[model samples]
Target chain A: MKRVAYPQMGNLGISVKSFLWELGAEPIEPSPISKRTMDLGVQNAPEFACLPLKVNLGNHLESIEKGAEYLLMAGGIGPCRFGYYGEVQREILQDLQKDAEMIVIEPNIFSIYWSFNYLHGGFVSPLRLYRILKFAMKKMKAIDDLERITQYLRPRAKKPQQVNLRYQKYLKLLDQAASEDRIKELKAEGIERLQELNNPEVKDVVHVGIVGEIYQVLEPYVSLNIEEKLGEMGVQVHRELFLSHWVMDHILKRVDRSSYINAATPYLGAMIGGHGQETVGQAVLYAREGLDGVIQLAPFTCMPEIVAESILPVVSEREQIPILSLFFDEHSGEAGVQTRIEAFVDLIKRRSERSVLA
Target chain B: MRGYLGIDVGSVSTNIVFTNEQMEVLDSLYIRTQGRPIDAVQRGMAQMYDKDGDLQILGVGTTGSGRHLIGAMVGADCIKNEITAHAVAASHLNPEVRTVLEIGGQDSKIILLRQGIVVDFAMNTVCAAGTGSFLDQQASRLGIPIEKFGELALQSQNPVRIAGRCSVFAESDMIHKQQMGHNTSDIIAGLCAALVRNYLNNVGKGKNIQEPVTFQGGVAANVGIRQAFEDALKVQVIVPEHYNVMGAIGCALLAREEVHNGEKSSKFKGFEMLDMEFQASSFECDGCPNHCEVINFKQNGKLIARWGARCPRWEVG
Candidate 1:
């Protein structure tokens, strides 16, 4: 079996490993992103490339060093720079003289079919392929469901660390589950274990919606574990960009994008590519839902998010919800981000108190 | 007399302030951090203690970049970010303050307040082009005292236009203007204008900067930048009396609030910490691939705190 590897994106490696294994390839799990990975990525990538691309390059380089023969990447078609990430990474890899084949799975049906056939050597029958795909999809959904539950319980829990630990433990168990029924059982058991930590006395938990580029929002390493930080600060975080949500909208074509698009119409009338429209739309939705505040995270020099960032203040004003926009780069420091978040929480809390008095 | 202590350990300066029960600043001190925050904070505390050793400290608060470290060291009753600290100080000084433009050593921020509540705020991200440190560098490069740089700008008849997008480009642009036979005062005035333009365009972007604006921070001492702001915003900018120590004053006020709201006693470790030997060290944890740098803080050969690890394995409370 050919050794296949993919970049790390949050818990995406779990489902991707399952998918690759089902396709009869040896899945090479690249090590989790670390400081060395960032260093290697920054040393090689173009000076102006977005952070995700640099980190992805580092993942690919590390995987190549592990003797992986094939690299799997997703391709896109949009005005956002993400669409060209694959091509740029491929060129960077070739320049480094790395012996690996780049297999890009585009958003089109034909590309998916071709990639699957190539990876599996056309030996896996259609029925078996369908079963494999369904199993992977189920795992993705299971992971996302557990994540949502964790977010819900994090702020309400007596010890938020307990919820975090339980979630991590369950993620490991779910990754090892072979059967669909086992996955379902594990997810239910995990949720029950996490629910036990929730404290009934915890009230008025601050709710903040996170809207941003998909990679930064989904990947903990890239975004600096912002959700966990907020959760520890006694704030419940909500985000629309889950890996399963991406799969549902792009791969399965099941999501109804109209509501978000309509909500974004006033601020961003057209899709400026990437998750920019989705970000604006979700902020509006969160505002309408009376969330305490909104946080927009974007990579420095990101075009789509820049457009969204510029327009978000208007939405913030019209909707009467405070929004904080944070831009991340390779040099982004943890202290600065922490300070901004602390101040933002304080601002919203004071605002809410004034309104109550009024 | 009973008082509250606030300490702001910023990149360029460390400020300590003592406030009375009515939130009035009784005494304040501003000292250079000089790239050593702990030492600077310790020195500032020693000086404040020397002058007001008899004042009973009811509560202790900390703000600025080194707030956590200092807060932990002093056993602060309340710790807050510089934004909230500055906003609180501004609003307390004048209840009608609608906007606050604060430019410190390495960070610049704009906070918008509505009815004494902070409605919106933005801080300079990934850039330090127009902050105090940059201005200090330019002043020294021109062989002029930073204290007199603003006065020189006021003497210019026709200010040249300087690019303010980046510090390197702005410096080069200033040199080019100087080589073209422009007066030093004109170049200084142009630099002030450029810094103000950059501040308004970057940190103050997409926000309604209303009148009753109050500018405070170490940089607020520059009359040239204040005049430039007045010209750009078309409103008289009020610089509070204790502009440089506003953050410390704010945290002192917050400390009072925190103490009054339910805390029976302050957690202050007391002023003797100035003489105690405090040490901080860090090492990379290789337990996982993340290799997080875990920091250990010690005082008098006793472990006080351990943090900075991504995982809780290395964290000590």
Candidate 2:
């Protein structure tokens, strides 16, 4: 197995590509998740599978057809059914007799290093491999930092489209940036450009926080670009979920989340896997920050999200902050999603206006 | 004569309602969209214009799947979703109403309200097995008029069991029941019961449905489905007089509030807009792999509105 491919999620694919290259294997680009890919996934997957699994299956098949020899996927271990996805996908692929080797890497602090030692296997020096890993992390960090700027400026930019343009440009620039200084300089320049386009502050702007499953929160395709929609509707959206952040928090365990744990205790006593606790924690944090509303997006039948959904009403009622829970699947309609979002925005706007009068 | 105007364009029907400042209904009309929303909107507005002359519109609102498209066409002040619209209309009709069971042409939704505010809501878009279109298709297939479907269903003492998880499954099951010598009325009632079951399991799943539930939408016009709902919940389901056009009524109420809140002049372009020549055109933009089908609207050959593009490249200035 020479060339490896993984399912694309936001800009994580680029980072993974760099990782595979350093591992002495070429990385084939998984095709972008589109209607065709989703259709292919749905055709091969079980009818009731969640959206991400179907997309991942489609990505694997697309890469295999493109001559990818190895498939690198992550493993989940929790109450969430995502833990069984890898085994199920491998079984499905084996049943089809696809000409590819599947490798499921458990994403953990030690497992990541172990996977590194296993995939490399004396091809590259340990020192060089460590350097490659560090550079990839820097690349991911750059991507997340630039996205944070977009989330801040998109709602305030005089030409909102310009912020999107700059954000896209930064994605490409980050890919080419080899050294840490170049990435930092690019990040600084990107923030400066977005700041220049931002319009004067408008008071009483509805502030919303987005929290839910990681992919649904980060992948614009799944959530239907909800952050952008909220931005265009004159609502400032705060999203704390990022792929790079996940790496540091979940794998490295470096980021301090005592605040999240403390806030989630009243609603969720413990983590129920699949970011369920984090979702509730984030909602509470948003409420404390005086956000007007919070929107939770998840795939249909997501176990962890289902738990979060059940507990969100209590958080909403007690915190006096409104929450809108949106679930999507292959059959989810964009128009329906848009209608609910627009109504939710209007509801918050009206509620805030009434409060202001009182 | 200062009234608000509301428009609701769904997959199967286009409805418009006119309401006075107090949110009381004045005139309303329901027309089949027939796969062309623009023509339906224009025709409905033209009929409204022909009936009520010298009626000044204070504000306009649009709802349903095509809210944005029609809101732009009608110069609407507030464009809301069917959930909020249904909740508003239901609450207006029954102040203590806590649940709204809306089954439209191709979609169904369960909205939970508390203290006249929308507390939670769920919509079933992918599954059309329990929607108005499903009933319409089955009615046509069984050689029964849709208007009489409910009346026939009410006559059945023993409703046969039909799978209502998906439209295809339900159709096949209906055929099997028919092949087994099931009466037409029993089969119809069975389908109605199945739809109610599917709805409660899917759209209303995990939703705390409280009493004083108001069932509205095109499907609510069917007395059989209404009774099935009553039997399922064991609570009398109230079907408002304007159940079929509640979305439009809610939109009008929203428009009235929007206009009153800002205390600004109405943005309505006036009835003269109906006389203007407006055209809509769509084209696929191959700038990327997505090839989004961007839509644009022109009035008298001037591009006035454009959307549906993922990037700025396909945007019409």
Whole-model Cα lDDT of every candidate shown, in order: 0.91, 0.85
Identify the CAPRI category of the predicted complex in candidate 1. Answer: medium
Looking at model 2, residue A259 earns an lDDT score of: 89
> In candidate 2, which residue ranges exceed 4 Å CA deviation?
A21-25, A64-67, A78-99, A108-123, A255-271, B52-55, B93-96, B156-191, B234-236, B258-277, B288-291, B313-316
By summed lDDT, which 10 consecutive residues of candidate 1 chain B come out lowest? B308-317
> In model 1, which regions exceed 4 Å deviation?
B261-263, B315-317
On TM-score, the leading prediction is: 1
Q: What RMSD, rounded to one decimal, does every model reach?
A: 1.3, 3.3
The sequence of per-residue lDDT tens digits that candidate 2 reaches over residues A1-358 is 3778888787898789877876777789998788878888899999887888888898999999999888888887777777788788899999889988888888765666676666665445667877898989988987888788788787787767778878887787877776789989988888787788778864556789999998777778877778878877778888888988888887778899898889999899898989899999999999999998999989887888989988998898789898989988887767777887887887787577667776
Q: Where does candidate 2 clash, by residue pair? A: none
User: Model 1, range A1-358, lDDT digits (tens) per residue?
Assistant: 9899999999999998998887899999988998878899999999898998999889999999999999998899888888789999999999989999999889988788889889987656678878898999899999999999999998898777678778988988988898899998998998888889889999878999999998888888887888888888889999889999998898889999999999999889998899899989999999999899999998888999999999999999999999999989899899899999998999888988988999
TM-score of candidate 2 chain B vs. the reference: 0.95
Worst 10 residues of 2 chain A by lDDT: A117-126
User: What is candidate 2's CA lDDT for residue B285?
Assistant: 82
